[model samples]
Target: MEGILNILKPPGMTSHDVVDFIRKIYNTRKVGHTGTLDPDAAGVLPVCVGGATKFVSYLVEQDKRYRFEITFGFSTDTLDKSGKIIKSGPVRFLKEKELRQVLREFEGKIKQIPPIYSAKKIKGKKLYEYAREGKIIDIPPIEVTIYNIDLVEYESPYQVLIDVKCSKGTYVRALVRDICEKLNMPGYMSMLIRTEVGAFRIEDAYTLEEIKEKKPSLQPIDKFIKLPSVHLNKIEAEKILKGQFISNRHSIETSFLKLYDNNGKFLGIGVSERNKIRPKRLL
Candidate 1:
């Protein structure tokens, strides 16, 4: 009831759809998704339950890996298969080396424009909502880092599979669009599979059917949150829990830390500032 779930979300189900399923299975209202995954794509999505929901903010910042296919025939409104085709062109296959060279330009830091039909919010209103209402808005490009990108597989003149490792908030749909532009051809994201999210891998993720039929173990919150820990005595722990700051010249130079009790039990998270530590979040 109070742990994290690494779910293998299926295509066609939005991130919130998976959260709703988990809410019923666990019978808890305090369920949340770490980040939004596109409904047309499938892959590893982390879900937090009960007290673990407090750590959702941290999980959303983790890097991610994905495998996707780009079809070089036409482009769409959504930049994916889910959208209407806006333009069509003859398929021209690029030499493997040519494509690889183009991909290198995207490695490292680059500005990327998110798809309009996405869950990105503007003033608490989702971008897709505006798009559906036939409202025109200038979508801004964001800076995202692509740690590495490689040609996974090439399938003739129509489709090619690619693997990418990127920082948080990188949109694979936009990556495909950019790659096509560099080729001077039209393309759309044909398929997408998120292979990993931080330390969570697709192979280790559970599907909804598996969860409904089997009694699987829920992973501890500490399993994913990698931070230095500080142990406190009962007296100090009580004070920290009561929103009182403890002054100490701690050797660990971190802005945040995982707090633990004398018995080695996780006490939530603490923020360190000006040589004083205060509870940032508690279970």
Candidate 2:
């Protein structure tokens, strides 16, 4: 049972909760999740089974997409609906033209300050720990990329829906807060749903119940990896097993190859640099 699972994590369950559920369902400790979906969020959470857990570091490089709602005229400690209200004010609904222009500011590379009540660690302690202790600290700004952002619709003067595509580590709650600040109104995330993560999408996701009933729903591990396969002959296979990188400079393809033995066994990953191929991982 080693492969990728498009698990539909329901709201109110932490990412760890889902992982634990899978570990029990599969009766294996090798289970792991590709990304962490917040407790209040629900959607596609890719789960790694069996040896796929070894590739988690590489999967984290993939981008994520989300659809979330923002509630204006108020702010919360946790920046979401579950948090305590810390501030409130009147919010004037901006025109569509105005909203569009405001959204434009978010596209491309931008600096973002993460919400205080977050998983970020500060001085070897989680930021949420400090937040829980009512400690305020200057959280540094981080550079992040927002590939795309579109206003889905305005649900009300106080609420609006937005779809976003961003690089890893982006916090949608913070994005909503920043947008509200730009509009001169306090804001907090009212609802969030991660529609996609990397190549996984919510539409293909299976609920926990579905997995328990359907035993063989898991896809092959290599299907989710999607790396460029490079078949190594007898001589080349030995070099890879010995932690050596061999160059295929003689060949037309110059990019990194998803290494595989002559027997078609996946041998982890490798990169081609100059005239040499360096192994990045070993199965």
Candidate 3:
């Protein structure tokens, strides 16, 4: 049960709900999801089980790829179709050339203010909790990298489909809102599907029913973590397990390295900063 399960979260269930479902099936308390997907969003959601739960931070930080639809003419409280309409205005749909030009402007690093109805925490409570109470709070913008954002297709006059590849913590709904403002038109996200998250792809994801019926036949934790593997002898492996810093003759400059025993047992993740391997966690 100590591995990663790429769950195809249906639109109706929250990320927590999927985690709970896994927990009940496995009857383990250590199960957790790498990131949260809004209830209205259906796509790849990596679930960590057993010792894999300790590496949630690493998975959460990985970049994501999504295919989302941005619908023009109105804005919502949640910035998505799931929320109530907060404002409406004349619809001004942009042509493919104009939309492509506008999308190019977000190809690099940019600052983005998260939507008010989000899971981001203020103090100890989620920001969405405040929004539910009809409270307005200023959430500052943070630097996020949008590696690629291209106009995929336009299904209708008001709906523009886009494919986005961005770093972690990026809100596609908020991105739609920003792009709408750039076009001098208000909009909200109509549909969203996360295609990838790091090495996890949507194609490998399983529906809740499929998982419950098949049980856990998921990939190992190491599959979810993309790192260079370094084989270690018994002596080095013991040292690594004890959380001792080990120096190797061969120097490879990488932020982290995968430590494995002679038997090729996936030990855990380790940092190789300053030519010293300091073990971070033990699997």
**Among all candidates shown, the one with the greatest lDDT:** 1
Q: Give the alpha-carbon lDDT of every model.
A: 0.90, 0.85, 0.87
**How should the candidates be ordered by TM-score, best one leading?**
1, 3, 2
Question: Runs in model 1 with CA error above 4 Å?
Answer: none
Mark the 10 consecutive residues where model 3 has the least summed lDDT.
248-257
Per-residue lDDT of candidate 1, residues 79-183 (tens digit): 999899999998876799998999999999999988888888877788899999999888888999999999988888898999999999998998999999999
Tell me which residue pairs clash in candidate 3.
none
* 1-283 per-residue lDDT for model 2 (tens digits): 4677889999999989999988888888998888888888899898887877887776777899999998887899889998999999998868988887898899999999988888888799889999989888989998899999999999668888899999998988889889988889988998889988888888988998898888545676666665677888888889988998786744535465678888998777787777788887776
lDDT of 3: 0.87
Looking at model 1, report the run of 10 residues with the lowest lDDT sum. 246-255
Cα shift from native, residue 51, model 1 (Å): 0.3
**Which window of ten consecutive residues has the lowest lDDT sum in model 2?**
248-257
Q: Residue 100: error of model 3 in Å?
A: 1.3
Per residue, candidate 3 scores C-alpha lDDT tens digits across 1-283 of 5888998999989999998899998889999898888899999999998988988877788999999998888999889998899899998655788889999999999999988888888778788998889888878798899999988898657888899999998988889988998998889999999999998899988888988898957578887677788888898899999989888644868888778899998999888878678898889
TM-score of 1: 0.96
